[model samples]
Target: MQSSSKKETIDCFENAIKNLNNVRTLYTENFVNWKGVTKDSKEYYTEIIAEELINKINNENIISENIKPLERENYKVPSRGKTFISNTNRKEENVAKRIDKMECGELGHILYYQMPLKPNNKIKKVGKIDLVSFKKDENIVYVIELKVANKNETLLRAILEIITYYQQLNQTNFINSFKDDLGDKYKKVEIQPAVLLTCDCRAYEEVEQLDERPYLKELIKKLDVELFSLSLNIQSIE
Candidate 1:
């Protein structure tokens, strides 16, 4: 006869499998009837929903209590849309945190990640700067926008975002608030905007060409923002 603990473990596995089968059936039926939906869109939604269901099942307390832990292994979740798998694997926020630890000689003195910027009398935050560094020696402030992917669309959007941050920081009241945050060391600081890319993909070359466009070229010159790229290396250890 099966032991009580063994039976419970078997039951947990059965329930999880049953739930997954139900999810699959529902997904198939829904997709078949989903009119005007593109194939890629359908697949994206189905994969996301399936992953959510798996997560829910995996988190059940009953399963945790009854089943023994499985051996550790790497799992790759399906990518959605045009996103690169590497970006999701490493995570943009994680990369940004790592970058925050680097010394800033000309970059800045104090580095802040996800700094909130709100205009006067506004309750809602207008925007959150990805990274802000200050150089007390030169009285210069750097607003850095970090992106995991170097896609053209992503770079363009980041450019606009950093520009907005620079404009807001230039406001008289906003500058006063910034000075207060930085203390007396940075009494007068000039704002410099920048976009940092983690990957050296094809978009890097495209961004260079984009800089030559008359309107974009003028905007970059006027904002005095710099575009920089950094690469990350990873090795496996046995």
Candidate 2:
């Protein structure tokens, strides 16, 4: 007969397996549902849940040997100092982090976030790319900027920032540096700039009505920049 503790361990393992399968099913169904909805029409809640599910799975400790089990008496929360930043900047950073964590399929890989850009050998830091990702199969690289604002001016700023990053990345030295970081696999990828925004439904609806819409679209086309938006009310999974 097995000991009580051993029996409990086995039971836990079985339960975990069942939960994993259930989550897998949920992810598959949700992904299919997401595909059916047009990009603009997709709800923030749906995207949040789908992303949370992926994060949950990735957070699971699959390699038991790599993680040491702690005794109840030994477990304690670590102390950390509170870091402060403006609310607006925090939101922008949070959105960028979310995009960084997302899985981009087998061919896609996130290259870096907050990648520095120093133009023309200038000592001052000009700007940083919010997120950069590469798709190996397509030989394409994405330079993304995350914006928490719905304002047209903010949108334009993000577009300019990404364009600057793109230009810096296209430089020979910068390309060589990236090659060193990502290896030779990304040697010949085409870079594309993009702006990602988090806005409420009303703001999103008003975007098309903005006077800058035509000029924005023209600039996007001219610069080969992609525009993407997500709803602002994405809830955190507890």
Candidate 3:
């Protein structure tokens, strides 16, 4: 790659990393200069924004980071889940705990929940991956972000989180942490990012399309991530 081209790709990645969390509108709004849009031009302008983001996300030049000196919670659920998990996330943790205890069934066995990533801020608040698992007979590790029914998060936002975390996981550290659990085949198992959605979640609803392909679905297909609509039988404590 030319020096200029490589630099451009890095810039694209850094920009997306900063704007990812703030993205809410799927088609119309974007990180690019888009505030001046008019109603008539909204549809046309949206396509431009979508196409631009599509190019950025679909670009194969983005760099993936491996945070050396990586860490995990082993396979055990952390006690901080009770206090570290805020009331808002306590509800989410309820689901995380249930998934941790129950058999993965078609989803596969849980390796761990709340996988940590490098924190960008100085205060050192790290983001946690919802769940990580492996299939019974497959050489693939699933890094999953879960959204339960009626979650208010936009589909695009959830997609970004999984993609970012998948890129940030250190392969050597993750597998070696459970070397005894995976055996020699651990070297061959690849990390696959996934979104596990409970039926009727906002993320689930947004991806449902027949007349035309949803941009989010197209992006997921282009990025090669997995999507699963799972049915969990846990009764809500809310």
CA lDDT of each prediction against the hidden true structure: 0.48, 0.47, 0.57
Models 1 onward score TM values of: 0.49, 0.49, 0.68
Q: Give the candidate number with the greatest TM-score.
A: 3
Best candidate per lDDT, number? 3
Total residue pair clashes for candidate 1:
1
TM-score of 2: 0.49
lDDT of 3 by residue, 1-238 (tens): 1122333333543555565443322222232222223343333222233345577655632323222233442433346454232346355556776666355766688767776664333524346788878875887778898877655555655666677566656667777766765678788887788988887676676567412334545667765678877776535533
Stretches of model 1 off by over 4 angstroms after superposition: 1-90, 119-125, 150-154, 170-184, 201-203, 210-212, 234-238
Q: Is candidate 1 or candidate 2 better by TM-score?
A: 2
Please give the lDDT score at residue 164 for candidate 2.
50
Runs of candidate 2 with Cα error greater than 4 angstroms are: 1-89, 104-108, 119-122, 149-152, 180-184, 201-207, 210-212, 231-238
Among all windows of 10 consecutive residues in model 2, the one with the lowest summed lDDT is 68-77
lDDT of model number 2? 0.47
Query: On a 0 to 100 scale, what is the lDDT of residue 96 in model 2?
Result: 57
Q: Mark the 10 consecutive residues where model 3 has the least summed lDDT.
A: 24-33
**Candidate 2 lDDT over residue span 40-122, tens digit each:** 33332222332332344357632221222211221111242442333443566665555553545532666665655543344
List the candidates ranked by lDDT, beginning with the highest.
3, 1, 2
